[model samples]
Target: MQVEVISSVNEACSGKLQHRTAIVVDVLRATTTIATALAAGASCVIPAETVQDAKQLTKEGDLAGGDRFCRQISGFSYGNSPGQYRGKQIEGKRIILTTSNGTRALCKAMRADHIIAASLLNAEACAQLAWELRRDVVILCAGSRDSFALEDGLCAGLLVHCLRQHDRSGMLQVDDFGSAMEALYRNKANVIMETLAQSQTGKKLLRLGQREDIVSCSQINVLQAVPYLNGGSLIQRLPGTIAQTAAPLC
Candidate 1:
């Protein structure tokens, strides 16, 4: 198996991810929120790259969740916070999710053989599912806009660590972004919290009084389901369930 990490969605095109198993990361909030929703029993999540797209999907009969900058858009039912998705009955429903960065990354990876939405919340489950599928994996980080975000990179490193631990025979490849992720994980205790607290996007969240989101997104493996994108919908693959499934289609 081979592992590659791309920093932004713009760098990941259909040709680049063709026939490859892709893992999408947006740990600051979007991916984390999705994992939480699935863990809380959402039937599936349909990622939309734009808010307009999300609204259109809703008009066509999909439940819509609009998240802009950590806040729910006016007239939308939910924001990007994982806390909001909890304890709600979302089973047997389809969520049309649009976020600032994460959903766009999912849209970009739609052409991959296997596309899984991942975050620190479900890092271990994502890695385990990847190993079960036994395909070369590409970890794509949805950086803040077109630039890097420490939170997403750190989550990518955690996924790398999980994959390396479970499948030692596989080859691991780190890109510039992946190397930065490894470095960030190495010094997480000292720099991550403070750096995030001061980051441009992070500060905006702070001003919005969502400091708890930062804390929640940083925890590793709080969710047990690996949210995989299949046929334009996101499905959760519980641990010990993939082995019974068919071989990866790609």
Candidate 2:
């Protein structure tokens, strides 16, 4: 199997992800928040490309959550922080989420055979699922403001590393950018939290008094909840929940 890493959402095109398993990473908060919300027992997450779209998608029982420039959208139920979703309030409720970069990246990956919301929190589970699906993979980093974000790149690198670990044949081919990301992961694996704290986005979060969020998103392989896109919603699944045999998109 082959794996390609997209540096940022702006660099991702649907054509590259056709018939492939796409793993969208936004570790600074978006994908991490999705996985956290699912692990916390939310029913499903619907990613929207815009705040207007997110508002429109919300029904009476649904919750609208998103952020712009790292601040909560006015009048939304919640912001993009994972901590906000870690409670009983989200149980059995649908989250209509839109973000500046992450949700846009998810929508950009809609052409893939399977789309999985990924972050450092669930990298191992996502790799295992992608390996089982037996499709070439594309890891799209939801960078901040159309530019590459260090935290997202680190998570993509972690995904690349995890995917290679599951390659039984040892023939997994990774693109040049993916290889570079793998190197980045190896070099900073020991100081992940520190690295995140030093990143540009990290500094911004700190200025906004969100240091806890950076700590939460930097943990590697801490969660098994994989947010698999089923139609317009992302439903939670575990590593072994999917059949090993290749199946059509549900």
Q: How far is 186's C-alpha from truth in model 1 (Å)?
A: 2.6
Task: List, residue by residue over 1-250, the lDDT tens digit for candidate 1.
Answer: 6778887776777776877789999877889888988887888888988888788777544468857766787777778887777775666667789998899999888878888999878888898888777677889888886887777777788777787788665466656666667667767735655666666667888999989887777676778898988888888887677656656433
| Cα RMSD, each candidate | 2.7, 2.0
Q: Write the per-residue lDDT of candidate 2 for residues 1-250, one digit (tens) a residue.
A: 8899999999998789998999999988899999999998899999999988998899999989999989999999799999999889999989999998999999999999999999999999999998888889999999988999999889889889998888777779999999999999999999999999998899999999999999899888999879999998999988776664676422
lDDT of 1 at 65: 84
* Best candidate (score: TM-score): 2
- Worst 10 contiguous positions by lDDT, candidate 1: 241-250
> What would the TM-scores of all predictions be?
0.89, 0.97
lDDT of each: 0.79, 0.91
TM-score of 2: 0.97
